[model samples]
Target: MTETKELSRLKLLAKRYARANRIAQHQALDLVAGELGFPNWNKLISVSKKGWLADSVQMASIEAFVTRALPAAIFRDGDPEAMARRFAHLEQAERGMIGDHTYRLQEILHEVIIAGEGWSIRIPENPGAIPIVETFTNQERECPALEPEFLQKALELARDRAVQVRAEISADWPRRSTKPDQSGMVRHPLCRGESDVWFCLHCDGKITSAQIAQNLWHCPACGASPLDIFDTAFWSDDKGESFLPVKTDGSTDRDELDFRIVDSRPKLDLTEEKIILLIRSALLDDATNISEKLGALQAEISVDDENGVWIIIEEDLWPEGKDPVQALAVAKLLGLEVERLSSWSTIPFAWPRLGEIASSTCDYTQMMLDAYAQYGGSPTK
Candidate 1:
């Protein structure tokens, strides 16, 4: 078929979906392409440009496959449009399948986890939302699972986006749109490093402007700090050309307290009594002010130098295994270092497993293992 005919047919399909869904024509096209084993509208068009034809057999097969493969949970709870849109994104994800390897979508988390028989890759990339994607199990990369070829491709995809977001964040934070040097070339607002060239002080890597910015002003190869970046190769054998001197007010995050806490998080000024009260409050049911809480439970809490919270509950009073777990959940949520102080705690006869949730009540998780548990079923209204 001619290009005109193919384009017309695709457009017709797009238009039909758009009208039915009350979405834009392009969005419908993207959805259609995503359903038909293509990544996006652009990808669909790219194939069409290279002599792809909209044969009835191919289109019908795709429709049939999508119908068969639809996740039942899509229509279970969320708004239909929102859930469908999310599913479309998952359908377009880059996947790798080895022996019995396949990708699975965790609908609740909106995550497409690609795993082979033994390994899986997690791209910690969301430059626009999260400033840094600092996860690496190696010396040179964020994604531990990607091979050189895959790593390069991932880098290419992430490079431009990361830099653009970082620039925006830096500029916005400084109350400026952008920063340029006296020579009219743009300098980064955060570090005032030359926009085109940089030397990583920590890893001793020479990188271009785009490369440095893409790595969030750190060494992408080594995941160094932003402070370890310099405009000149000061550690080089032969000193490089005149460096672009950076301008900055020296302000580092340091606490010179009388007694140092020295933990990952800043200390919360809660006394032992206050801590116990808070835990007790979180564990309470409908009633507040501590008087109307459940069961006669006593808590003995101690915090170590690392802020590791060790709680010895009078288990005899509480009676249920779940009561201690509820309190533990609260402590975990608060990011307090928690350990259930063992009375006979050496892997007892029964153990409660909430999976990754850290807390699950007996009332919940009664359905299928993968199913999202609905809380407080059916609103009073």
Candidate 2:
């Protein structure tokens, strides 16, 4: 009975040792398999680095068999100290199969720490208290709810602030040049009826009439409205009119008088609303004649002698505090081409008062005013 009890105790100890050894070996295999991108030990044993059929299974199986047998053999035939040494050898062999790198152990430990109850700890209420490992674990599961009203309000405020900032950053454009030079008239090399035809200022094309009734004429090609025939030189094929002299031919300047109307009006298409907007904007302050104002505005907006006008809107003149939809409607009604400036703060123009800042520390209006004062009221020409 005593012998049977001792044999039973030995068997249980041997089984426990074998189970520990098996677990260690399995862990090592898992590490190697992960490194090689294999799903499990079976796949790892079957496949080689190049993925072709090799002696990997035979090699690993033989290694595992030898490793498992050695400890049992030492325990059965050798002293207690020899068995201990054999267990230590087996542990070293298992670790070697995985890797000798210190980082391997750290990685395994870190994964274990993250996966286990290490995540359930709570953060200390004391501000000065140092964080423990458990505080980090609890944070992973924390999902604090946000108030919908507060979030919506914040988003709206952010949107308004963004618009204000955009306005402040936009560029300031210089006044357009409106010079009545050679560029004002674009001449076509092709003449109408052997006479050089110049572009009519009113019709925006070549004129073809000799009769200047009421000092006004219309374009035949475009059928545009009539224009006033201003003091200018024109060519004609016929010799039967009265006007300025081309040369000092003392005989009543017959050649100049007989000049046929090649070109008549200036090419300016102005709408009533546009004229009003221009007047309101202080762009056309000095204008006894509507035509003169149109001419000047056209010239001021001209960048080159190309005889085209480009109207630019001052940043501050746009409705900042008003409804965006209404503002857009106003711009469209005025018949002005509006472009939203990207960087309003950098634009050369007066910064209009948008609204009072919610915070005293960040007063955007005040900042813009100071910047405008420093940069001067208008953009440099």
Q: What is each predicted model's overall lDDT from 0 to 1?
A: 0.43, 0.30
lDDT of 2 by residue, 261-370 (tens): 11122446655545445533443443223322332243223222332224333333333332233324444654444333212333322333322221332454456567
What TM-score does prediction 1 earn?
A: 0.23
- Decoy 2 TM-score against native: 0.15
- Displacement of residue 314 (Cα, Å) in model 1 is 45
Q: Which one wins on TM-score?
A: 1
Clashing pairs in 1: none
Query: Which stretches in model 1 have alpha-carbon errors above 4 Å?
Result: 1-113, 124-186, 192-196, 214-227, 232-381
Position 134, candidate 2: lDDT: 27
